[model samples]
Target: MYRVQTSLTLLLSLATAIAGSVVHHDDSFQPDHILRVTAQNYTEACTTRYSVLVNGTSPGPELRLTEGQVSWIRVYNDMKDDNTTIHWHGLTAFTAPFSDGTPAASQWPIPAGHFFDYEVKPGIGTAGTYFYHSHVGFQAVTAKGPLIVDSNDDPPFGYHEERTIMLSDFFNETDKKIIDGLTSSPFKWSGETSAILVNGQSRQRTNSTGSCQLASICIEPGLSYRLRFIGATALSFLSLSIESHDLSIIEADGHYTKPLNTSFLQIGSGQRYSVLLKAKSEAVLKRAGKRQFYIQITTLERPKTLTNYAVLHYSSGTPADLTTVPLSPPLPTAKTVQGWLDHKLECLHPDHAFPTLNEVTRRIIIDVHQNVSDHVIWLQNGYDWVQSFPQSPYLVDIYTGRLDTGGLYQRAISQGHGFDNITRTFPARIGEVLEIVWQNRGTFTNGGLDVHPFHAHGRHFYDIGGGDGEYNATSNEERLKSSRPIQRDTSMLYRYREKTTPLAPSGWRAWRVRVTEAGVWMFHCHVLQHMVMGMQTVFIFGDRNDVMAQSDPVDAGYLTYGGSAYGNTTHSPVVRQYFD
Candidate 1:
């Protein structure tokens, strides 16, 4: 037994070496580093309390690192309350297949007052905006925080200063309460959000005097500075603007884009964007050699639904006149608008440019449709995650085949057991152009309720045509011309905007895939709640027959296997706060 353990340890060491050189200067990350976090529980006092165990007064601290470096972080759950796991969102790496932190698929939860270590190499494939949060069910309220990476890649338009804004929504309810509301009650039917929070504070008074009670970060005018924005809302996309200045959009999801000079910027949950702002100064005051311009952050979205604000404050040396930058042209609406209709027309006419076969050699279509009853629930490819409701104490075994109500399990039951169908396995071939047709069919909008921010790890895709379920040629051409740079990991699939025929088939939203890299990747909605509802699927590149690809789901029976090839055990409906 001793010899076998020694051999395994040596093998893991070699693997670590081949992956990258890891450096740990902080003693907190040491193997012996252990810390306890506590979740504050409260009720409906306008400013409600949350049921999350956090490291400090706030959530967690900012983990700063340079490019081309690897980091190892160990989180010890000292809470006397629940199990947890931290998921490094937007970071691309490979460890234990299950430890990637998708509940039911990864390892089980981290028992209260336990320990887990994450081996992370930030900015490996790409550099820019990304974040880290909890992976347990419904605990994101306590575990989410910002994971910022600066490439030392400076901007062409220089700024005097820069700051990072880690924005998140806070809930006062406990995980158990939230889960109960989501699973057993009418909350799912109504499409209600818990509450909105900026940073960890509610929109209450900020200054010392009662008159100045508000969460306000004051700034001076006449300076060009950069603001890094990371959105961590469970729902709701952020529509942001400054009351007086123009915000120059420079980056999204941590990836750079051609600078977009605009007044209003829209950011979805789990998405990030950066902007440069040149604060305006009052001309008459400047003429008298006095600074006069300042700006206030404003929102277009309803304030009560989801709270959002900005960070980073600066002042310029010389007082000068101010001006608002012209609004950037709207993003190509082809994929977001006409993509479905174009594809339908192409399917009927068989055009050369719109070829039947994609440049991608492999393809998989995911149908995120609603299996609506009077109950008003949603499903991913016909499977409802209803079984995961109520946060049971004991770890439960979930048979994926038996998950869907009318799925392969029903066939097995009718055919006297062991009869499995409809769970087809598509083995991935190297260098194939992989395509996935994501269809939204059911009762709610897009045949499904709730807007989904579709995201895929490891690759970006081209937006194809889609309509309100009916394919049209004109719609296709319009969308095709509007294709923008491939989004790194996040995109939105909104329900039809028209009021008449509300549930019209919102056609299709297609993305092209180049499987240049080989690995097991996940595609899911960035909305934490939507993901918990089973809006997730995994794609395997390379041969599925490979030993690594053939393993069963992580958390098989829901306990630590002392770490598998997929790393540690994680909980289902991956939440973003337990890691805090």
Candidate 2:
């Protein structure tokens, strides 16, 4: 036994070395690092709370890699009680589906005290601002960071400096308590955000006297900066604007687009935008002497307005405390924010080139709704996905065909199972262009429409169009024929409100993706709570033979515990049958 363990360890080490050595492009750089997940006590929102973190930081460390480079990231889970997995948000795992970091979909959660290695080569055309976060439970609300790929191809625009602005919402309660409340019988929603963070830090007012520190971004006059805006919040959708500055958006979810200038920007959870900010001219700064601007983030919902503030400091001048930053132009009212939303609704990502699809091979319409039985549960197409445990994960089961004859698989195809036991899987052949229309039907109780940011795991899709109302095929055909669309991995399904009546038509978003990769890819709402309640499904592309033949040995070695070349396990009868 001891000898076998030693041999496995050596094989893993050699595999890691080889993975770190592979290069695809001349400008590619191999970025290899290890992140340890541990429980840490940190203070936020004027309170100290116990939370799970990566490398001792809430936002973790920024992972920088050049385009066309292979990345090897080893994550060691040292949390005292919980298993963890990190999902690279907006990244298409491509050939490495097992490394996609979705528990029960790509691979099982890494048991506490164990580690997993994620290896992926970001080939050409994968450059942009992205992020990584915990995919299990409420951990992602605090455990997340930036994943940036520098482009080998020079960009059309020029910038003197760059900054990554990560935004998140903070709650005073622990993750466990929050999860318990959200999933409880009565179905209590997490109340308004206690605080908002800019790059994981913000001034939390303890009392009327105001006791806390603010995060400041220093800037110099006469310089252009590329600000990478990442919306990492768990629940909040933010409407943000820098005082006296107009933002020119150049990139969305890692894809460069034509510059679109806007006074304010709306960023949904799990989405990213890269905007170019030309600093105030030196002449203007010298005339004003000392000045500072407030970078404000406000919630887009109504009833009670919540806002968070960060400081944009000019290095040449000093300003008063954060509280005293003059409110020359008062924070935007909800009405003003609504106006901006209406104006920018038609062209959210206006600059992306449209795809030339001879025809959409498949069209699937999915409806998002909520049902209350034992608890309030979110549903996709009338099905709630609950991860089955103790059994092999979905990928292993599908790849091995163990579940092919099982009742679950049969029901999945026929759509004959109850909502609680339904496993939604849409099958597609290789190279087929799929058009998915995501329809959002608001909750039943309040009839209040919520904006859901939907994300796909294995590929970026071309966002053809979106509108508020029931999806009409004839009308959609006309719209798609006239407009060119942008490519993105995550997009917001906008909600519209009725002016006179309380009931509004549902909103629908359409995107087209070509199924080039052969694997099980997940598509779901990026809102953590909604996902936890069950708003997700999978797209199984191609046949099992195609996927298994292309599986990376190193990745399979990790999944099967370095046992054998084929990585068969006894728990999964299907895997055992195929490999043994």
What TM-score fits each model? 0.69, 0.84
User: Residue 59 CA error for candidate 1 (Å)?
Assistant: 4.6
lDDT of 1 by residue, 33-96 (tens): 2224556653321454666645654446666655566454666666676767777676653333
- What value does the lDDT take at residue 469 in candidate 1? 59
lDDT to native, each model: 0.48, 0.69
Clashes in predicted model 2: 1
Worst 10 residues of 2 by lDDT: 571-580
Q: Model 2: per-residue lDDT, tens digit, 373-436?
A: 5588877776776454325566766655654424543454355321214445766655566778
- What stretches of model 1 exceed 4 Å from their correct place? 1-37, 42-46, 57-59, 94-99, 152-157, 185-191, 204-213, 218-220, 281-358, 385-427, 442-449, 458-484, 498-504, 516-519, 544-580
- Number of colliding residue pairs in each model: 40, 1
